[model samples]
Target: MAASGAVEPGAAAATAAPSPAPAQAPAPEHLFRPISAEDEEQQPTEIESLCMNCYRNGTTRLLLTKVPFFREIIVSSFSCEHCGWNNTEIHSAGRIQDQGVRYALTVRTQEDMNREVVKTDSATTSIPELDFEIPAFTQKGALTTVEGLISRAISGLEQDQPTRRANEEAVAERIDEFIVRLKELKRVASPFTLIIDDPSGNSFVENPHAPQKDHALVITHYNRTVQQEEMLGLQAEAPEEKPEEEDLRNEVLQFNTNCPECNAPAQTNMKLVQIPHFKEVIIMATNCDCCGHRTNEVKSGGAVEPLGTRITFHITHPSDLTRDVLKVTKNPFTLGDSSNPGQMEKLREFSQKLDQILEGNVKAHFIMNDPAGNSYLQNVYAPEDDPEMKVEHYKRTFDQNEELGLNDMKTEGYETGLAPQR
Candidate 1:
């Protein structure tokens, strides 16, 4: 070795036995904390990786767990036995939400600063009052408290300050002044605003008074811009112009969603479907690998029509009751009379007829009403129409919309500042 600590040209000729491996150091058990009865199912998966601190092989354990009142997340804990340094981070394990979410919190008290926050890697955190921001992708996502987040920012701001003070005195002094403002935010001096904008809609801030409106916190949702879409890697490529009929068959689009029953991450396959003599609609189907659950929904252009929800509800009911609602497809004959006794007898008659269709050699018509006009029952025999099978779209009545809880959202007196909850 030279005086300046440069290695000699023949240093490769030197040989020595490597040091023995250190005893494995375990990570804190808090990363796998039990938040629910199913927590035992979430075992941590370990992977060997190079530790950032020691540049040596270390273990990284990842556990997928569900957070109460929130969603699923994967907690990662890394430990290096050689350096005795460990770090933990959390990543969202749930599906991306439909719309972007923005949270603006007014931190007024110490309790406010203690509020929990789930900031995803794609989320942007900013203190508007100080004009400071931690841009998206600049820091790893975390499950932490507001005070803990501020302390982390302070540590980052003060990192390598001694060198800066020695070499860049003026820049160091300005940074010192900024650090004081960050400390004041933690002290809740005159209150400050903390904002988190997540285009992926995965970030969240706790509401101490959950189920009740929190005046100190404001949450809003909006669609993401084109630039935001590109940043998120969700931007779809421009399609080549072609005939309208060829648009759907050209590609099968897949989107990420969640299983309705288990809420596990799932993928939804979608393709445009055309019903003869009707408008085109998109059909999406989800099959969960975690749980043996499957769901399919149809959309004409906007929202998912209510027919799917009705089908889901009917499947939950017993046979007799399900037959009553499902009679739209099985039996079209009306049950006579509005009186309770007569209706009961009519329902009894309908049930018996349905059993007859199932057991006897009776041919019954199968008529389906899809609100999005996505159903197709092609007529065979050249151009001949099939009278037994019909596919149709019907206008949902106002009462049906009310049954869907959509009509109940209307506020007639919102200008008066008070609208009663329905």
Candidate 2:
């Protein structure tokens, strides 16, 4: 193959051989030969090709080069002289690596953003500080810099809608602000981390703090997740797909447990239910056939929602009981008398009190605090400006954060004149 080079060698002239059987040498496969030298400078070779966009004749230049902490790479560039269009691609000259690779670099300055990165199609890029991630499926592999990656993400951010599902537009605006901050990092020294995780092991980031100590960079090896392996077609066998019914069935073994209300031995039933958009939940219940008493509740599937939610309703009249109310809980509760003789009396009494509140004899407030956005309450009678009854929805609070297991942040103490010695 011809390479992008300054000098083109001419065809060798055949010299007449005097020997009876002339010694022959095979022709070279490449148009431009690679030469070894102390400086190790190689020439680029140019070849003619069709324009990818316009389909017109163009010239493609190929150059072989080495990068800092990476093997040889082929730089292939195309320029259509007729259409004034051009593009470039980089390919590794080395074999596929064995293990998945993760490259992380702390970008502290504008110069740090300029460091080169070779990303493959199987790579996912992320910036934890910005809460931004570019999934492998959504991005194309490219030889770019940290700044280039951030710029591409910014472009995608601008395409989000001005209005979206409740709270989505606000989120997009926040992302826009974050992208602007990233752009400002190009002119300032704000520190951030750039990470590239590739399952195919075809991606690389310039490492300046390695054996050569060219820059501050860290490289790590990791095993790919099942999903990642499947995405990269590295799975040796396809995973079995369980039937929907099988997933819905509760496989828990029945156990004898005492009822919290009656302190009587009861059988407990537990199973997992997959909730759409919300998450999986474990529905558990216990019933005392003797007392006709039953209790049920739900537990979350172990994922935290992005924000907390609060719901409140006021019961002012008997008509409010007729209004539709949706209460989706793992545990199902009822406000009624029980036929079982062993049923707990406190639960029966509470049921009666709830009925009294619904009858308007005792005005009460119904409130539900859920961070997972899994519960709902409807207010069909209230108008937009209703004064007597109102529905309030607000963001999650610090206490909610604590409940969701995300409130572990610790800040440094402010120094004062207080003595430190005991």
Candidate 3:
């Protein structure tokens, strides 16, 4: 065989030096160069994309968690490391499988897990921004349906038919002027929500439509007091009086009585006595004989009751006299069929004074206790200390008196008052 182009193995291998391989002619400058404006413009802009399964192909994927309700569509360009290829994927709402089910399950599970994890982590996520606007509803002219009309009426916006017609021409002129003004300003206005509170503390909220120019009038209606306005004319005016009018008026009053205990030319002194026991005041007069003796005993000539050792006055407004008498009988201090005579008298006197001041529109009553002791005038009610009368003991006495009618009790009362006709 002729010399074959093959080297003999292990036959003194030729020690020939090997030539160096050529250096990669420094990669063309353009190959490693920064992008040019022209090239960039021609090149498709790179976008990050993600694969749902891997979730790692892109630099970063937008988490569309904030707007989950809206379809989450992420447009990204990803270079697949495993396949050595580049492509774009749009993970849209439709691409998401079992979205509803996954959302429900994952949201609940993730929320619970996140709550636990967040407790340990100090990082706080920012809240999503909400961009929303409320719609404006404004209408001019009469509303169409009955519901619309009713709503307008309740809000005090709709005027009566006659009033509306009467003011139509004027209102039209005003509306034209308003429209012109509004056009000049280039603004849209809505109905005012009028909030009003009444004297009774009830509040109302209403939306009333009127020209913005007429809003002042609408607000005035809310500020007006209907009930108080009606009474403005009827309110009483203060009366001017002379300085000594009260004293002169009191000095002219007279009473007829004699101290039966001393029988020594008695003079009666009237006073307005306030009773703390009953929370009332009475016009009571006592007769003093100037011999260290006094008595409220008296003879009745007019509507007044007979002389009692102790007298009391009941005062009340004239308008309340009848009602008070009926109420007093049912009061806690009533003695048998009658109320406390002293308290009743005081109520009567108070009522009388109120009647005089109110021109018979008020009334009062009067009562009296022992005039000798200051207890009656001092607001101290002690039935045990009085020999002639014992309110505390009268409960037992009146129980027996109930057996005797008024006529029978009067006969017994005449016997107790006489001094043997000496």
Best by lDDT: 1
- Candidate 3, position 146, lDDT: 21
| Lowest lDDT block of 10, candidate 2 | 2-11
Instruction: For candidate 2, give the lDDT of residue 218.
Output: 69
lDDT of 3 by residue, 1-422 (tens): 11111111211121121111222222122222122343432233343554333445443222211011122222333354653443322222111111111010011121122111100001111101111111111211110222222232222222232354476867545434433432322121322111121221111112111111322222222222344333222233356554363553345345454443323345666443334442222344565535455434322212212322344444334432332222222222222232335555665565455446446544434444432222333323342343322332112244333322332443333657864332
Give per-residue CA lDDT, model 2, range 310-371, as digits (tens).
66777788876764433212111111121122223444555567667766899887777777
Question: How far is 9's C-alpha from truth in model 2 (Å)?
Answer: 37
C-alpha-based local distance difference test score of model 2:
0.58
- What value does the lDDT take at residue 399 in candidate 3? 33
Best prediction by TM-score? 1
- Those runs of model 3 whose alpha carbons end farther than 4 Å from true positions after fitting are 1-155, 158-231, 235-238, 242-422
- Mind giving the per-residue lDDT tens digits that candidate 1 earns over 322-360? 232334222212212211344345556666776666554
Query: Which residues of candidate 2, in runs, are more than 4 Å off?
Result: 1-41, 155-178, 212-216, 235-422
